[model samples]
Target: MCKAVFFKKLKYRRDVLGDVIVNKHKCLYCGTCVAVCPMDAIELIDKWVEINEDCNDCSVCAKICPVGALGGVK
Candidate 1:
């Protein structure tokens, strides 16, 4: 029972920390942001890297993007 409780808490933490968003219109299709994201939450689709629900909003992708294509929620 104790093990089950610990797993449940861990799952909750993971879910809460995962929040990321990307603007498709601003995306440059350079793939630089995708490559820099540590969480692997960004993916290229139709020349834009879409941010998934798993994104942690670390801003790494945005910082690395040369063209300022990626940005997190303000």
Candidate 2:
């Protein structure tokens, strides 16, 4: 018997940015975070906003969140 290990391929490289989080309880359902991303990495999905891998860790979204819903560790 032979054992093989394989790694999945990624289409895009992920940045080593601090964990970006959206505080759902504090979120206002506003589109401010989506509009502030220079990389076009944020989107308002129905009710909540989602951040995609396109994010460059620029912290723009975090800074723009009026309620401080979005943030990065560093």
User: lDDT, candidate 2, residue 4?
Assistant: 31
Location of the lowest summed lDDT over 10 successive residues in candidate 2:
6-15
lDDT (10s digit) by residue, model 2, range 1-74: 22332211222122223646778899998898787788898888988877776777788888878999887546
lDDT of 1 by residue, 1-74 (tens): 69999987865565455544456666668888778878888888876566765777778887787767665444
Q: Rate the local accuracy (lDDT) of all candidates.
A: 0.69, 0.72
Q: Lowest lDDT 10-mer window, candidate 1?
A: 14-23
Estimate the Cα RMSD of every predicted model relative to the unseen true structure: 7.0, 5.8
lDDT at 47 for candidate 1? 65
Q: Over the full model, what C-alpha lDDT does candidate 2 score relative to the true structure?
A: 0.72
* Clashes per candidate (backbone, < 3 Å): 0, 0
Estimated TM-score for each candidate: 0.61, 0.71
Q: List the residue pairs that clash in candidate 1.
A: none
Candidate 1: stretches off by over 4 Å: 1-21
62 Cα displacement, candidate 1 (Å): 0.7
Q: Indicate the residue-level lDDT of 27 in model 1.
A: 66
